[model samples]
Target chain A: MRTIGLEDIDDIALGSSLLGSGGGGDPYMGRLEAIAAVKEHGPVTLLDVDEVPDDWTVAPICGVGAPSVSLEKGTNGIEYPKVRAMMERMLDTKLDAFLLSEAGGMNSMVPISAAARAGLPLVNADGMGRAFPGIQQDTFTLNGVSTNPFVIADEKGNCTVLYTIDNDWTERIGREITTASGGQVTTLASPMTGAKMKTSVVKGTVDYAQKLGRIIRTASDAQGEEPEAFFLRESGAMRFFKGKICDVLRETRDGFNFGKVTLEGIGEDKGREAVVEFQNENIYAEVDGEIVATVPDLICLVDSETFVPVTTENLKYGKRVLVVGLPCDPAWRTEGGLELAGPRWFGLDVDYVPIEELAARRTDA
Target chain B: MRTIGLEDIDDIALGSSLLGSGGGGDPYMGRLEAIAAVKEHGPVTLLDVDEVPDDWTVAPICGVGAPSVSLEKGTNGIEYPKVRAMMERMLDTKLDAFLLSEAGGMNSMVPISAAARAGLPLVNADGMGRAFPGIQQDTFTLNGVSTNPFVIADEKGNCTVLYTIDNDWTERIGREITTASGGQVTTLASPMTGAKMKTSVVKGTVDYAQKLGRIIRTASDAQGEEPEAFFLRESGAMRFFKGKICDVLRETRDGFNFGKVTLEGIGEDKGREAVVEFQNENIYAEVDGEIVATVPDLICLVDSETFVPVTTENLKYGKRVLVVGLPCDPAWRTEGGLELAGPRWFGLDVDYVPIEELAARRTDA
Candidate 1:
């Protein structure tokens, strides 16, 4: 286990945002939230998934909602306590640790906040290597960890406890309640226990996020290099394309910012164009009208000059961005992953081609 | 209790689709699929919620996915059995009855297909009086019936059972699994109980759907009768406006068609414009650049000439449509209902208005 101090927040935010790939919601507020939590509660211990004791009671904590709305309705910071208390009440045991639900965006920071406040260790790995839109998308779904006894806490201090027979219904019903509660944010705690955590949590993600974050910053400062390049080097990502946002369309529905942005290629990508579709985060990145990156595969848009992350909703016409893609957890590359997040999964007709291959093509040409 | 016959299929399809208000998915396919099931297994028995014996084992069945995708992938009659058997296995009791999860679209018919084969009595009322995008929005969620031991059966005969602590996780994890299962059509059977059904269901929805279907078809056959007028006379609906779709943009994300469409007013609504947004069904409606009708109210768009229902995805530019609004269940107008489906719930800065007020304003101006 490693100790995480306040200094880790910024880097973790950047890395987690990259992993968000467009849909886990923004990490800015989450970072601020986590930093404030840490300051108030003290440093948190970050443990690898493998390091979790067999008896440790590890529960997941995260928020579900549109990032746009979150900005308008800042959180009440009460959900964590409510969910934590609910789980403890249900299981009749104190939570020994908190873990990230997904290693992307705001989700990555939630456990840190929860852990800091609860005086519990935080596991590094997440249920998903990248972000997915629903609860059933977690690797835990495959691992047979049910999302039951889950607690949803709203900003108004109203907490609803559901014991659904299945995960999908939880999402369906939760979404409606979430919408009704203002559609911005709802806190959920689920997939508890060490035995379950062993199978469900992706090992070593917390440290990975921190390490990924640190590498980008250190490499850039040391080499006077592009942060994006530093990220690509550390993560083995491939630069998909560089482009300028030409058009962006956004709408809020069912508690999400569902939108798309069209990009006209620039710089090394002068002759090409692309459209990056986002549901909170960019889920699909199409270059020259061909899908080059998709869900389950990490697709991040960064400032063309700085390589800093740019959220999908914030992208505007004429804003220059470099589209980068990284290979996801190999678990996500499996048949299940392809079926869950492949291009065809999004109604785009194409098999997934690694970003590396697309980048290699440019070099070869 | 009423015995449903083969003749009821046509009207059920028509009326249910109308009530679906462009969100419930295509009733045609659901109609045909159920018809085929009925043909093979005989007509399903429709029962009033009161008809259910206190001890009767009951389950609500429906598909969860992007409506367009559900139409394309097709049910092929696999999900019903999967969920039925799973529920049976989990509860250790024979499912004595089946019910529609919602009264609109394919969901209304999906249970029919299952009920016919299972030889279970089908409840007339649904959890949601109309249609909603996710699981938690149902009357069941509001009524405090957990959708647990819910079974999600995919087309490939792969079934995953999720036990979420709450309803929100069900949607997320179930959607992720559905996506992983190659975007397969899925059926979920949830909140199984006789007593729970009585409290959570919208009474008489099945009969309502059937009768609504009959009215529309009969209106078309009769000379000089308007379908909207028939709906108003029978269902207390108010004519909101008449317009042609001028622009539309949408995307299918996480198994849902979520977006917005703009309408250029025509006839009584000339020179005025509106935008209708949908998450499965029309949830927000704005007229003349002002918010008119919003959620918890039935916002419907019917083909101007035929009065056939128009789904969100099917709505295209140049299609003339009559926008109508109906007061939703009194339950929806309640504080809880407003919280669940209100305009403000969707992140819009507007208060909920009754359909009558919006309709009266149109005539006054």
Candidate 2:
């Protein structure tokens, strides 16, 4: 899509939620915010990397906190442009476009809202192919970009322009502020140039999410085809499990929603059980005590019938669902990316194995 | 004291500790830092409020965190000037002098070091006549000054120029950053004009602390007089109790040392028990089941023999000490000041009757 008009918000939000892997907070709020902005300011131009000059700058306007809180307390929308303005003044330059922080759940719509409100175009790229739990889990951190000179602002108009030693400092300080400031803050961090964006981001994830959203919407409402089956075929994703959510355990601590979900298998996989673990996003999944999926691969849960994305925060008991896994961006599979956000980085006793390999083995067995 | 030479540091440190009311961390490290600063850059001029132009700018550079942590992890000294520079840049004006945040313990020495390093005069005035646990406990907050446009920085060069809606926001956000950044941060906050400083701060507190320090030192060194008696005679301070510390419990949490000290009367009042409760600064004290003193009043613990100040962080079992009560600033007795930092504000159940009244009742009975 060349432009993100009001009508595209649902598809993009839906598509991005699938990429969210059951995290990035709920996408519904972001969708509403993006729709309102587009309606008020007209359609925001969606630009390809080639459409912008090399010198153009792009930065993400994102929120940081737990899904447990952010889902309930939606953005007031003032913090968005306040952070934007502070960033512009602090950096002593004008922003040319907005870059999505991640092509996951609600965040996929955050840049849309920010760009539309600022009357600027949005580049179809993101720091992460999908959202991860930590600030250091971004492509910008992997590509040697500093998280310094960033701005964080709360809805009450309290703001701090922070400069830290590293991304770890950025995460700790930022998280502390987020948790203390009513568990949510709008942030403008890690501004990258158009030239750097080409090499430092997961490209076209915005376009991909929008396409997937469209595919799911059209197929779900169609006469013959089913949404999940269409999504599986079009996105080349593997069905990790098909079952009903038997139990879910979620606890929000230090501004993160850590959770576990147990699914009782159904359909062809009757009489089996599947377990999924998540910290803000789904991190690992096992069926009958065998490892089936793990991050940094996308592990998404969706409604069994309508193919609507169900975030980790929205997981509930007695809900029929399908567990899906998709290959992460090629960059995330690199040695550097794996070291930065792989299972070991998250304190898990597992090695980095591509989802394609794991899914191929599961199918073969 | 017209200038803060290296020799004056010991007396200031000693005297300030008396005003500390068992808070403001420990004075030894701050003394060393101030001495080194003065030795390297010569003396820092001590300016009376009237010496500065009416339009001259003044602000406080102080440390915030648990006295338990701040005492052990003394400032690296870099953070002080860094915050000062950020405040200057953000306010877009040069500071004419440094105003001590409080006239208590280590903090009183902090401004001395900061002023010497910057080659600026240090005003004899201070925001609080005694050091307090929270940022809002200062006279500036009492006088209706805003804490916006403050700067906080850590030893590692990470800094934030913060703007909050009120002092409470400033305290929470600043404390969060301080705790997360290894539990120490230097802050430059509440810049006021020379005109405001005259009415907004306690006058001649530096001189008062220095004179008290001199009384303790000379009396302890001489063979003729006992330091504690000499101190009481000179300052018109009342001796609350003479005892040996029987038990002490201190825990550093959320960047403040919460503590309790149980003292058993040793001389003149044998078989009597006294309990003191503190959060950073001494908040309440009770002797033999009678409410003796509470906050908005100074409750100091000093060595029984030498009369050297004993900070809350340094309280230990078996130490022979004298609990002294000095009158707090007259401003702190005002309705606004009492409402801001009275006993109830620190969660104490006692009302803020001046120490003079409490001591007079005990003497009469």
Candidate 3:
């Protein structure tokens, strides 16, 4: 697998936006910020956790809480340094590298920025393979890794490190501060040595992001080829529906951008109205009264013409979009996965269906 | 402060019902389970962090996610052992004691159960004087300690430990797994040593629980005294409104009992309707388009006659309930505290008003 450069992040952001469904926040600003950091510090080396040296201490870098604040307020890139310094001081040793906490939204780009700027190798994996609203939504926690000695950094340049004895306390304490900090804060936490990383971090996410990004970018550049088609070819995603956004209702409450976006279906499914409800991320997709796609699987909305991601805030009246569905990591498809990211979990009473099946049904009709 | 015995937990559970305010689930089973454990293992000692040895590690124990599950499928004493073992394994030494993560519902009682079984001292203080959802909502996390090394135990005998690099990760991962686990899991996390506990854990919560419990029990034993008056004397909580539940809409989603309970005001505030919204715990109270008692303060609902807590699920049409208001921990009333647990946080558009003031306004009218 090839490594990603700063220029490659644009494609990743675009693809991530599509994968984000209607809710990964705007990826452009996060992309720009990541690119700026990469440009200043040089391309970061992406290392598989298996390749990490046994002695190296690897820390996951990311942001927490409501994505609205993360997008609107932006990040200061301060926590990374403070966490690094504190961890080194506590252990009396220099750190080895950084890892992404997840593959969705600004958090996906945060570690890359921190890795490049800090001169540390970036791990190619994340805790959760996708986006979630809280901290403990990762496979590592499921596998028993604590998110501790966690450091929280605010734009005001205040950095506080918590060396808690347990992960729940880490969440309780961190949430209070993040809530107090107005629902968005950046941090470096859950420090583990490379040996632990191999067992815990999801392998090969960095390469996947780079490849996904590259394919989308290259396909768009080729002879009027559609970016959505390129992404479908590369990631095996299926176009579930094509429509124009008819209505969008949003409210900022509980530090989350919550509401629904309705789309009027076109083509074979013309006259069908579908509504997708969102809370920080698109959780449920319903076409008319029937459930089409639910969470734990990717339900992404791509620009009909260019395949660029159309975010929830940007989704508006008459904007044509192609809704695509991709199966989440197999782990997310488990009973545990369904419970965490399934339809019923989000308040819907439908079982999950793959985008491919939905597309096949649509095409058959 | 005087020590509390296992015998005292039942009375505390009864009194706490009044304080829980039509939420906080039913503390009876948890308290009974805890009492049984304490009776079998001997009374657990309650200690202040400052009284502990310098090197002793103190972990906070609590059940995360929906309390409804606690009523349906009782929680076994597991997380405390898992956390204690994890810490012991980490330091190659046994933990000296344990602490409650919060003071409300089964959480307050669970720690005593864990302490009794594990032969660990139970700290008198909790992270929150009452309950609020999310790991980051704790005063300890707000002050500095991030809840980490979070140990979660499921009834299926699966115990996962998460060490996120940050507190948000802890919340995310824990919540995700909690969703995966059907929303009722026990967690032992945010372990701080005795040194930090002195400054971090909210002091005297366990003893306070015992005292409050004793007051209610004693009053009832003497003359079946009103639970409301007992609460008022103990915590300075005031009677805000007397009413009957007119409407209740319940939806169990994401492991949280989220929805609204509407009360038809009686007495001086008669003819007016009030709605209190809750997610795991009550966060907002409003009456006839006016914000009454918001979060970061106590919103208790009692049986108009018995002054006992009525779980949201148990609240039925025409059930008489007294809505009592009590001051929150002054720390929560601060700007930081308000942001973390205030009314706006639960999606209401209003500033927080002290429960006392709201009660006074009612009396004045």
Q: Estimate each model's TM-score.
A: 0.55, 0.97, 0.56
Fraction of the real A/B interface contacts present in each candidate? Answer: 0.00, 0.90, 0.00
lDDT of 3 at A350: 79
Model 1 reproduced share of reference interface contacts: 0.00
Report the lDDT tens digits of candidate 2 across residue range A1-365: 39988888888898898898888878878888888999999999998877768899788777788877877788887888888888887778998998888877778888888889999899988888888988768999999888777789898989888888888888988888888798877888898788887888888877889888887777666657666678788767788889999999999998899989999999977999999999998999889998887899998898888788899989999999988898898878899989988888877798978888987787798
* Sliding window of 10 residues with minimal summed lDDT for model 2 chain A: A219-228
**Ranking, DockQ, top scorer first:** 2, 3, 1
Q: Across residues A1-365, which tens digit of lDDT does each residue of candidate 1 receive?
A: 77778998888887777777766667877888889999999999988777788878777788887777765676788878877886776566788887788876677887788788878888877888777777667777666677776666666655654445577666665665567566755455564677778877677777677676776556556567565567677767678788888888999877678888888888778878888887766778877766677776788887777566777656778889888887777777778767756667666667777666766776787
For model 1, how many clashes? Answer: 46
B-chain TM-score, every candidate? 0.94, 0.97, 0.91
lDDT of candidate 1 vs native? 0.75
Which segments of model 3 are wrong by more than 4 Å? A1-365, B1-4, B21-23, B53-55, B87-94, B157-173, B224-236, B265-274, B286-292
Q: Please provide, for model 3 over A1-365, each residue's C-alpha lDDT reduced to its tens digit, 9 standing for 90 to 100.
A: 24558667776666556555555457766788789988898888887777788878887887776666666788776666866785665455777888887776576677878888888888878876666655666666666777766767666555555545566556655665566566777777787878887887667776666666666667667656555566678767666678998898988764567778888988766988888887767777877776667787777777777666666667678899877777777777777767666777667777877656765676697
Give the CA lDDT, 0 to 100, for residue B5 in model 1: 71
For candidate 2 chain B, which ten residues in a row score worst on lDDT? B220-229
DockQ of each: 0.04, 0.87, 0.04
Docking class of 2: high
